[model samples]
Target chain A: MPEPVEIGRLTFTEAEIRRFAGAFDPQGFHVDPEAARQSPFGGLVASGWHVVCAWMGAFVRAHPSAADSPVDHPSVIAPVGVGFGLQGLEWKAPVRAGDTLVFFTQVLEARASGSRPGWSVFHRRNSARREDGVEVMAFELRHMAPDPAPGRG
Target chain B: MPDFFYEDFVVGEVKAFGSHTITEEEIVTFAREFDPQPMHTDAAAGAKSVLGGLSASGWHSCAIMMRLICDGFLLRTAGMGSPGVTENSWLAPVRPGDVLTLRRTVLEARTSKSRPEMGLVTFKFELVKADKTVAVSQTCLIMIGRRNPGARLA
Candidate 1:
């Protein structure tokens, strides 16, 4: 119905990139700046995984209910749902240090779950783009939420 | 480092990686900063929900898989970068205290028609729990360098 909501914005820094890389994805091009410069990217580039992780962080912070909420426990504007699956994940472009990204998510569909009597499944399309508007990553996330309709469950 | 290039990956070869045990603390911490759904952050709420108990977010599972892959082989391989993911499915929920391991199979390998210095390798990845239950399955492509001494991209 409405245009996709703008979730949040994030800028990648070398240190942040390396910190994530060191912990989860320590590829040479991801961890060593000098080695990365000599690698195919010609400089340090955030791992696709790192970009996805940062996107999650930004998405959570910018969530509608996250306003004025504490970092650990935010106001529950909507019921938390179970993550089911993801579809069509495309890392279209490289994310380098210093590049800022904007995130967005749009609800695609929501229907009652036949297997889970009290729950509804929602499909959401999400994307992250650079300041230049080049897309870095896109995907469809499927999750299940409690049915909101009164007496429906 | 010796060239573990495009030639090294053989079709049908399945490689298993290290494992990580999911913990309740990490699940709540990650969900608090990322997914933050009640089922993930609130234990009592989660237990009352369909999941029956607290569970790890699917994205958290992806991060764990990536860690195992990096530690298993990507760190020492002649890897370029991946174009994107074609398929990613979470078949089962990952709960705290579950030990998960990653298994990868070389599904396809072909030289890049446009970039001679590199090749494309498609892999089938799965996250299997301690009881041999697969929680997540993914198929994706990676760009890898060739073995030729003068074929380095940088």
Candidate 2:
């Protein structure tokens, strides 16, 4: 079993939550603090997508080799390639503004891709917990990465 | 207060929504903050990558799909929230300038055994391009409030 790697921590501010939600979600509970108080969530909450994106942001930034590489550099290899899909995504708890979340990813399986030459597939379990230790979100992500073996496709 | 309630969704019902156009600026901006791979952030690097040209990150496509869902009927529905997504697939790269639409189908609906006030609705959501190609698809269960929780079946 591969050990879990910490992605990094993130604090969800009201402004950032509102900004992201305004663009992609626009739900009252996410974008409007006052309106949210009148709803079931009881306060301004981050969109579920925002929380997922935060995990991605932290994961990309934490990659040792991919970090600090110029965006235009041709030789810059990303830590992971395009994702095939995700499964069993869960939002267990509400991520309200001012909450800080710690993220982690653990590799569940890895193998050569049968269909995509020169690429390998990785199945990983990604999760996040609030500062209070409540697990806020989790999902199984499948992505492809180029095989590192020399002379491989 | 909303037009749609748990009782409103009929299994196998299909609905279409959205006509949002993906833009290069939005794709780059979203990627710069989240995914940030070369193919998603830089046009030149994208041209050199396997994705062929500048493309929206898969997560961005999901976000866009969420927006379409909200605009479609979620906002006017008694949508409590989603427990999770059972599956999400990125079928094709979403390129800039591609107009996307959402095709939503209700797969199943059942009243919650634990919470009679709410019901669980399973849906298959597809984000389709103008050419009818599905770029992304997701299957998930959402909790919706029942319009009349105390009503009895005849």
Candidate 3:
């Protein structure tokens, strides 16, 4: 592995928000500038899932460790499942289209599956903060990553 | 495809079903296109590094779910798009040969206070495996027609 990757602060402009919203989540709070003013957020906002996706994009782009790693082209590991019953995601505030978002992700753990060889388990933890200097979203993403050394997945 | 109008939706309703499998070819294709991680691309690389073996990307799964919903239920539905989703839950790992399925519950439905011709339908979606293990879950919001087929926002 190259090194741990860290994505700096990322802000959102109204136009980018509108574009992303219009494509995947065109709705009252995302597509229309005026319509969003009436929602609980008081302005246009991005979807939490989308926010996570965006953070992933930026994080990968900014992290030299991930960028320099000998990872697969598309991706090597896919998440097997998510524990909804045990998740600790809290959308503290709506991500308005105009505000910026930032995140910090680190490799938490890597364990080879005892039941399945040639398949290891990789875990990553992401902490997202809003532009106002507040941590807004956090998640522990577990996937499959490979080990460069022998006998260690 | 039949148009699913607003009137066809009901709160507390659940739809259980399945999707296509996640194959090695698809994992590589998606990884190469967007994720490019060792686990998602090379089985050996993934096996050696962290995940132990080949895996899929989370976004790829989300995109697959979108396609499934659009084809299985949302196509030609007399409904507007969504603002977005929240509280996505992936309960288990999906692998090759795994047949993806879904179980969705209609959580809420109400006519828009301002947009008289349209109504919003909110649902909680659960993705599962053939063995009935919950793989992924999420809450989705969609707008549907009240009565008119051509009801739209201007």
The best candidate by TM-score is: 2
The C-alpha lDDT values of all candidates are 0.80, 0.87, 0.61
Question: How would the candidate models be sorted by TM-score, starting from the highest?
Answer: 2, 1, 3
The collision pairs in model 2 are: none
Report the C-alpha lDDT of model 3 over B70-95, residue by residue, as the tens digit.
55676557645465464566556566
Candidate with top lDDT is 2
Q: Candidate 2 falls in which docking quality class?
A: medium
Q: Which is superior by TM-score, 1 or 3? A: 1
Stretches > 4 Å off in candidate 2: A66-77, A115-118, A147-153
Question: Model 1 segments beyond 4 Å from truth?
Answer: A66-80, A148-153, B149-154
lDDT value for model 1? 0.80
Q: List-wise, what DockQ does each model earn? A: 0.49, 0.67, 0.14
Alpha carbon lDDT of residue A9, candidate 3? Answer: 68
* DockQ metric, candidate 3: 0.14
Q: Write the per-residue lDDT of candidate 1 for residues A53-134, one digit (tens) a residue.
A: 6776776666445334433231242354556677788888888889999988888987888887757787888899898888
lDDT of 3 by residue, A22-116 (tens): 54445566667786776545777775556765765565445334333334422223223212231344555677755777777776777785764
